[model samples]
Target: MRRIITVEEHFDFPDSQTIPEQTEPENDAHVNPKGNDPALVTTLLANFDQKLAYMDQYGISLQVLSDPNAVASTITDKQKAVASAQRTNDHLAQKIAQYPGRFAGLAVLPLIDPEAAAEELHRSVTELGFKGALIGGVPFGHFLDEPQYLPIFEAAEKLEVPIYLHPGMPSKAQRELLYESPSYSDSLAGMLGSAGWGWHAEQGVQMIRLIAAGIFDRFPNLHLVSGHWGEMVPNFLERLDEFIGKIPTPLERKFSDYYRQNVFVTASGMFTKPQMQLAVTEMGADHVLWAEDFPFLRRKQQVTDFLEAADLTDKQKDQIAFQNSQKLFGLAK
Candidate 1:
């Protein structure tokens, strides 16, 4: 069997730092009231040893762990956000130290302050030895394309680290316009505005916003990683190029060119062959990475089965399974 390196696995902040009210429903079965899967909650809160057992069972060799909630980004208070981010990264680094070869870390930045965020990214990489950073969603209702956030991108480029853009909860206006309705239950509406559709769509739009705002042109060598099969971007690249391509811009390359050059995508629990094929076809094998979105999708058999069954050559499979991540994050074999 090939060595598997999964990127997109997540860990939450220690309970002391977590605010119960702000915690998302998906992470708690009791709060969700709809998807009441206690097993998932258990898995999410599982210990490092427990996580390793599951990974061992599933043939996952190394997991690049991150904070799923992007906790610091959502914190409105600057001091609290910075402190939380430091605490979170410190906790993750301590955990990674315990199991040296079994785990790697992606820092969670306090994007509430872009300058502070850059400094934290630098600290996490230089001091904690984290592979990269993960920015969950729009902070303060602003996309990363905004000028205020340029420091974060610039820091990332200088550090030679990638930022994993993960899905975040939608805002109130978004819910009302696209998901909320009198016809549906609150839970159903919430689902519609979250994982079911909204999250992926929002992430896809953020990617476009970054491109249109000239983020790539400014920081040409900046690297980014997107989850959930490129947040639906891979499937729509041609359509994006077709429509956005004609728009006048100061971009040096086509919209798709930036994607191919600067972005990498991971499976992030979407394990079907068709999705895998689409990502590979659009992004190439070298640009793809494997991820199980652990704790949420804890099907040991399914993870191993999908990669084994996929119609890919040995080299291609190796690249997707681990090589791509090793190259991207400087992971050891």
Candidate 2:
């Protein structure tokens, strides 16, 4: 059996005490305090470590995303935030260093300036010994499809590394765009609940932007993978194709053609046999990878059970289960 490499998963940076308590107190209705409870991703990792040690149970290891640092939080100064990201990346790299087979690092580029982001990408890959770059699906209201940020894409292409577009908070002042819906309701749960809802929706829009902006045309070799099973875009791909075809554009091709060409999707939290089947339907087994969002949910057994029960050929199961990710991450063995 081939080893697996799970990309497109994230771990948020821990906040220093000096950052001040920016969290809004809950209505007592909300259990977790905003800005203070810490992101669940890393908490999951810590739990995973405990389980592995005591339970004698293990599953595939993850190349956890260490980007998407609190740079999005308003309290963070861009320069200071980038410095913090550097510190976190260095720390994460060391952790990976301790267990070479168990972990790998991803860089959090300073995104306020595109040129700086490009330079960081070069440093992360060229100097820090990291695998690839992780950018928020929409960086500061600028989608990855924007031409101004071509240098980042160009550098990733030049280095032939994957770009993991993990979801994060959109730029401030952009909140109004999300204000029109029920997602806009105030209160921590309602506000963040709505925003969490917005994350997947916004990501789907970003994927469409990538297609419409001809980004794939310029960087054909670039590998772009999304979390949460392409963030629900697969279910609506047909409508996307129809809209694009009717818009009087010169580029006439199936939307799936572009999707299958440049995109890969990970089955992280929403993994089940039927949904995993839907993921394969659009992305194919080669482009879809299995994942267990450890700790926050249950351990590796949930994922193992799904894989064991999936109705796929042994070879197909092998690809989705492990082989494809190894090939995608250049861990082909």
> Which candidate tops TM-score?
1
Q: Candidate 2: worst 10 consecutive residues by lDDT? A: 24-33
Local distance difference test, per candidate?
A: 0.83, 0.63
Judging by lDDT against the true structure, name the best candidate.
1
lDDT tens string, model 1, 1-333? 889889988787754765633533232121241135855655554488889888888788999999857567667678888888898899989989999799999998887789999999999999999999998867667888889999999999999999999887767678768887899787777777887888888888898899888898999989999998899888888888898767877888888999988999999988987889999999999999999888766657777778878999989988998899998998887
lDDT of 2 by residue, 181-213 (tens): 454334543444333555667778888787777
Give model 2's TM-score versus the native structure.
0.80
Instruction: Please estimate how well model 1 matches the true structure, expressed as its whole-model Cα lDDT.
Output: 0.83
Error of 1 at 54 (Å): 0.8
Off by over 4 Å in 1: 15-35, 39-43
In candidate 1 the C-alpha lDDT for residue 272 amounts to: 81
What is the Cα root-mean-square deviation between model 2 and the actual structure? 4.5
Q: Please, what is the TM-score per model? A: 0.93, 0.80
